[model samples]
Target chain A: MKSILIAMLVAMTLPFGLATPACAGSGDVVVENAWSRASIGTSRPGAAYMDIRNAGDEDVTLTGLRTDLAGMPEFHLTSTNNQGVSSMSPVGEIAIAPGETVALAPGGMHAMLMQLRRPMEEGGTFPLTLLFSDGGEVTVEVPIRGIAARGPDD
Target chain B: MRRRSVLGYGAAAFGVIGMTLFAGWWRVDGPGAPQAVGARPLPLTEMEFSLTNHEDRTVGPETLIGSPTIAFFGFTYCPDVCPTTLADISDWLDALEGDAEKLNVVFITVDPERDTVEAMAEYVDYFHPAIRGWTGTERQIARAVEGFRATYEKVPTESGGYTMNHTASVFLFDAQGRFVSTIDYHEPREFAVPKIRRAMNDEEAEGA
Candidate 1:
């Protein structure tokens, strides 16, 4: 009887451990080097960056992002005028190829955290949720980094 | 007996309430009422020079001498920094309420090739009617920028085009053309606005 009870307990815990597979639809989408910029106290906006790798066999499109620290979240791209000027524009979608990765960094494509509710202190972490086009969401903890920190592509 | 008693009570209550309200209202509307007004004032700086306005007119720097000036530098082709900074400035100016008139905002373009006097006028107009755009010959603008130690340089790209890498500080100058301070392009309003107001008030106190 003792051995049977132990076996039943193990069986019950096994499903609990494996239950995570249901929420992570296409397996784990790894978010590496995720970071957000420190907010300036004024009408200042900050940018967040990271590398997204879709190790699964299916392509993934990043549809949206949400953060409590910002009034709104947007994906953006920074372009330099070959004529000697640099500018940034809004990027609508970022597609991640199967078994490939997309990077967001400074002076390139990045996530804009607008209307910051508080200043991002260095070494601090904040919660952000990234929604994939296929209705899957991944929550990440982003580290606050200095302005000089280079992104993956940089 | 009951009717007479009720009528007497009603008349007594009405007279007492009316008298109390009349006294309170009279006191509030009387000449001795308290008045609240803003006591803090921004300071003014003055400077004089003959520079060209975006209208191609030779307007002296003296035109900016009477009011506080917010100045920024960038070229016309700049995709992000210039417009973002200018838009922020416009928002800041709009928030100033009655304090807006005491300010003279200037957008000075570093790319003289594209930002002509007419072009600057049109561009600055897009942000705020109160903002003035200033552009001049390369040599003239170079001299002006030199006076403030602001710097910019051009680098060639693979497409045979060039990009300008320039300083991104927005300078606050007093009416006298003296550099009061510098605000980082992305600094929050909590820091920027209060500092600007302080600078203005300091100038006023000194003038007084």
Candidate 2:
């Protein structure tokens, strides 16, 4: 009976310990609907939007983002004035709670891909890496979409 | 002794006259009244076409030619740059005080897929009620953009999504539907306001 109780305790604690590393590892950051607009040969800028989900036990903050396709990647928010004029402002940090999701979408918050290195071809894939506040980073593949294509919700 | 006193008084008067002339010249030709740079002269490149306004009414290039029009190309879905630029134009108009009547601001939607006549009407009205919004079929919009040599493209994304990328320059046209000058996106206020005033003044001078 003593042996059986010890074996059961080990099994329970082993699973918890194994799960912790997996949760702490890279797969915890899930990006859905990541995409960028197509650009002409000019130095036109583009934007990318996606939903970021954190399925971990602790909170995480997105601190940095990068894409080789552009000169710089900036997180931004858009606000309208009383005259109904809209403007874009930089975002310093984006916090996500455990088991929650944060969305970067049009007409609100978005990621600006400034100074395109090359034309963003349609149906092509671009690489992006998002750095977290906890020193964790996740790299994802974003596919280019047409100019008039609507978002999933749109 | 009397001669010396008269000469001293004359010397003082000469000094005062010299100082007044110097001050007058400084006020007229100094940095304070420096010649304006980027002042676009009138009678820019002109083109004529008929298109539908936000009200779905037919508006021809003639409508743009009779007034000093501040034209911008953007889409309704543009959450930032479009609105910001439009707002800046509105602020400039307000700053003009009573001179707003001399200006006609027009927003041309580059995203024709979503910015319909009704949509443009609502979107442009949200800015300044006096501002005009213009949109037409994709072909018409393409023709208009091509005439201005503006560039735009649609890119595909994951999950069947896309975004419109286009040139960000603001085009200014005189009352003759002529292309006056192009303002860069990051133009400073000190430069922009003076350029606009010069354009308006040029129009008045031409009319006179």
Q: Candidate 2: deviation at residue A56, Å?
A: 24
Candidate 1 chain B has its poorest 10 consecutive residues by lDDT at B36-45
Which regions of candidate 2 deviate over 4 angstroms?
A: A1-154, B1-45
Summed over model 2, clashes come to 11
Encode model 1's per-residue lDDT on B68-117: one tens digit a residue: 67877786555346655666677677677678678888777777877778
Query: What's model 1's overall lDDT?
Result: 0.65
Candidate 2 CAPRI-style tier: incorrect
lDDT of each: 0.65, 0.67
DockQ of 1: 0.03
